[model samples]
Target: MALVLAAQRGRCCLWALRRQRWNQVQRFVKWASTIGGHNIGKILIANRGEIACRVMRTAKKMGVKSVAVYSEADRNSMHVAMADEAYCIGPAPSQQSYLAMEKIMQVAKVSAAQAIHPGYGFLSENTEFAELCKQEGIIFIGPPSSAIRDMGIKSTSKAIMSAAGVPVVEGYHGEDQSDECLKEHAKRIGYPVMIKAVRGGGGKGMRIAHSEKEFLDQLESARREAKKSFNDDAVLIEKFVDNPRHVEVQVFGDQHGNAVYLFERDCSVQRRHQKIIEEAPGPGINPEVRRRLGEAAVKAAKAVNYVGAGTVEFIMDSKHNFYFMEMNTRLQVEHPVTEMITGTDLVEWQLRVAAGEKIPLMQEDIVLQGHAFEARIYAEDPNNNFMPGAGPLLHLTTPPPDSFTRIETGVRQGDEVSVHYDPMIAKLVVWAEDRQAALRKLRYSLHQYNIVGLSTNIDFLLSLSGHPQFEAGNVHTNFIPQHHDELFPTKKATPHEVMCQAALGLILKEKMLTDAFRDQSDDKFSPFASSTGRRINICYTRKLSLLDGENIVDVAVSYNQEGSYKMQIQDETFLISGEIFNEGDSVYLRSSVNGTVCKSKLVILDNTIYLFFPEGSAQIGLPVPKYLSAVSSVVMQSGAVAPMTGTVEKVFVKAGDKVKIGDPLMVMIAMKMEHTIRAPKAGVIKKVNFQEGAQANRHAPLVEFVDEEAESK
Candidate 1:
């Protein structure tokens, strides 16, 4: 009566054990009869973006129709289109839409949904939300409300882990949240302690204090972030682990008290305490240690009666000593890598367990497969310290998904990556025969990914994948800091070859247009756009202006004959030749600059040209004459401007406030990361132009500075 693989059994006892699945099915039927006398019929996903889509796919695969709820901003979203039915919740802001529990429940009830799958973030771990779903007679596709309550708070979870015989990091998880009390606890825990939000995950509301002098400030920052993100300022302290690897075990459980561990994933290579890349099988893990970790995770799950997909995260040191970090009581962002290695659909498992069914596979039946890795593609500029960018995705290209690779995304070309949500564009996953093969596939895939319109971290991801240390698998949580230089080398100046290519492309384009008009014009004395609609002479002596960050280059192209031109950069001259073709919105250029032939995918939008090749990318801006573009230019600022487009969240000073270098002046939040703007030098704040909660643009001055000499003048 049960459907399991033939490989699940190697002996008669195992077959006998599987036959007991009939009992599990009978138990589920009795329980279902008490509830609604059915399996999951119609389900509602109480979330948005890629996660919503992910849950819908699994639901459809199981013959269950899905409903979607969307805000005004997401009416045209991909998930809304993919769902069987959809309802509008509220405005764009999450508080009025995604987090509106009553509205979501109303929609679910009106749609006659039997279960609500709170996919990952919004209300997924909220105990009150889970309980309300149960009270409304709708299945909450997650752990019981009791488990969410215990593990949702860090302080309570640590106590629970300790009681369950799981190792915990030594620190204070107390009721007193006073600053002075927290400082004392940090002192006792010794310098370099981790101050974390009691209810935080995903790197928000976490800070590391190095010593006594900096502890209070760091604690306040952590609390502010926590309060803004989670509405709770409760925090806990922990002894900081040095260069520890972040490894987590994937665990599943059923209502029949059955639990199993899938495997472990190494998420050590992270930035800002959040994982950007992840892999499964946790390279170099001791077989015995892996056994212990799996046992411990299963034990932790049973202690809380966890029923669903959960991740038991741990911090392992260089000596392989591991401690419980926290347990995410839902599917994780990096769950795909685990799926790739185990050949398991974690979402399907979540659905079946939520329906009171037993796990299809046991620990012995689940065999590990090849290695896999996941790279999180974000709309961020890594060279600018990973400043998030929000805009339309003008051009998007990615490697075609195959058996060995998968692309998980929620947005399409021309969709706007809103600033209100996480700026992750997609997750690129790859698998190969082994770790080294997988690493090689990841690098090749990154090269195939080409994006334009907004800044992205594709180049940075490529650099990280190619780094010898990363390729060698010598990874840690502090891997970025350890190899920042190699990971993010200095942006080399635009090569003369590339600049020459740009000039040739522009010149050839102009000539092609002229020839086009000459051929199509009816009148002889005028161009196509003129009243005569006739051929007209077009100038070829045009300047190709290129700007790469602060460095700018200008080249002039002179026509020699048909399809030939001479390019001049500075005092040097080169016989540069090239051909450009316009295909859809992309520009392809094949040019010879100083005897080196180069071919590149080029994108020219307004005053900028983007070149993406196998080696790297080049963003060069074309500037008009000084007189033509004078009104649009900002006279160089002597003080700080908004580094990127963000909301001015806080203002610590006003006009006439004296500040020293490195003093915190304001806090600006963009793409979900808070960046504190500090005084650039010892000066007086001349004026604060933007008020709190105001939108600030990149290079828009927020604080004007005046030195003593300027004040005297």
Candidate 2:
């Protein structure tokens, strides 16, 4: 006890010293920033989620106050809590909240903020919003309005790039946006043409039509999404580069007419035309090619007289030949990877440059250091075509963060991944001395990220990172689909040993609870109240039912007097013994299965058992009662249901409308992407449960259907 007390005292002293050091660092930063010449003292972050919190971190470091404007849905978000002042702009929708330019501007004025930082997405690339800031005498921490205007529109940017002698893809950028005109241009460009919105970024309004037959439908889909996201429906048809790699360079400029490039990042692997993983500097890019890419990006920035942080994107074919795609007129979602490689805080640079400072480091002064990788962790089901999900983040745990690794996030454990906005949860970024080491660190970190509430692509990211071709740096835009077979292999039954582990976890947990209850009562040593399956003389046998997906497995356990047990599953028996212990609010199981001992993090929530090991994880479900299962099945089989929670954008059928299988019934928008709910069979619509603009939850019946023959009868 004396030694323990001494150790505790030492820890307390260590903590105090660390706190003192941190205070010293903060004071030093404040003094240094005070010496820097900048008039803006406070800035309003006209955004939400991770980016807002990210900007606040740099702002706090610089001793600048930050004001956060959030929607009603983000009342309890981390960004709101971190801000010096927070205001609710409007309701949950983007139009009423984050994208409401006047409302945000009003908050900036009310809060006495001198600047507004539109942290990407909503108004980051908005030309009018930048112009509004200029008119209001408030600094917009981005490029000039003219630069945003030139680069925000793809046609204008392409023309500027061409005039700047940069290579551009063949596309139709004319003002004629008629269906006939766009179709004709697409035909001239050849089939497999790319339909993209003129004012689109982040793949929100982009589609590839593989053939002429699907061109019109794809065009209409892209236009609708573009209209909803950017409020513009004009599209440009371009030649789709088959299996091209997406590479982009990060460029920073100042009002003093100085610009520099922070190298390039490879964002080739994607889904739904959006990037999943990004790395820098681009793999397999030699020194000469890298120099050319950076120079081209710098030329593009200079052509527009760009300012602040921006990304110049390119599409590279197999021969390493590349063409300009489009320039993002603001800090990108994947800027952390570039920051990690270059050892620079891009957001801090944005603030300083926006304050009329010259480029901190010139082109020759900047240097690249290590390799970095950033994986976007999102709330989506990889098995269900990556459909986005919205729910509470019930149990969230992450790898220990260090200088080499970072978990950039906005939501806490109880916060919901809202249905009204993007489903991204966090970004996992890591850095190392080389590409191979960085890739290994990424996989290691992913294995430690465990989530229980909603479906995530963590496991899928592991598979993709470890794939052979990915390791060889042979990645393209079609990496996921091209390697689908290996990435998504056939599911097999739960291994018997794993099943034994699950059963042991359940039994041990029960024993712990029973012991706790007995200890609290007068009958502390009552064997009758114990749930350990202990018998007086003979072994006690009990049957356990566990669900793996839709299949149920039966396990027979015989408890021995020696505290070990024999679990039998389909003619195989194993000796298992385990104990449940608590370690810092988390429950863990240490089990010896057939003389092999292993430990795993055990989470039993909502009738499911999650076992997270060092290398892999397993999910076992508790069988639902028969009555409850029957009720759910009936509700599910009633009619076609919403695949996810979303707002109904368009409904094609009312009551009594007839439709066949695969017929488009309605269009729903969720997570800024469009999805079409189709008919499951030929039937007459009995009821239209959801109307246009109505929000529908997952598995809710959208359109009740009855068979035509049954209706006639």
lDDT (CA) per prediction: 0.84, 0.90
- Residue pairs in candidate 1 whose N, alpha carbon or C atoms collide under 3 angstroms: 523-534, 526-534
Clashes of each: 2, 0
Query: Which lDDT tens digits does candidate 2 get at residues 1-713?
Result: 99798667656644543454455456456545652457779999999999999999989988889999999999999999999999999999898899899999999999999899999899999999999999999999999999999998999999999999999999999999999999999999998899999999989889999998999999999999999888899999999999999999999999888889999999999999999999999999999999999999999999999999999999999989999999999999999998777767888888878888777678886667668999999999999899999999899889889867988999888889999889999999998767888999999999989898999999999999999999999999999999999999998888889989999998888887887788787975677567769646635898999998889999999988888999999989899988888887678899999999999999989899999998899999999999798765735554799988899998989888888899999999998889989988888889999989999988888988875568879
Q: Which ten residues in a row have the lowest lDDT in candidate 1?
A: 1-10
Weakest lDDT window of 10 consecutive positions for candidate 2: 13-22
Compose the digit string of candidate 1's lDDT tens values, residues 1-713: 13243233323433443444344446445544433334587899999888899888877766689999999988999899999999999998788999999999999999999899998887888899999999999999999999898988999999999999999889999999998899999999998999999989899999999999999889989998998788999999999998999999999999999999988999999988988999988988978989989988998899899999999999998888999999999889999988777767788778777877788688997767668999999999888778788888888888889866988888888888987778889999998757887898998888878887888888889889888888888889989989998998877787777777766655566667776776787764555433211235657465667776767788876766554667788888888777877765567788876677877887777777777777777777776778878788775356778877788888999888888999988999887788999887888888899999899988798888885677778
The residue pairs that clash in candidate 2, if any, are none
Reference-based TM-score of each model? 0.89, 0.94
Deviation from native of the Cα of residue 296 in model 2, angstroms = 0.3
Model 2: lDDT of residue 457: 96
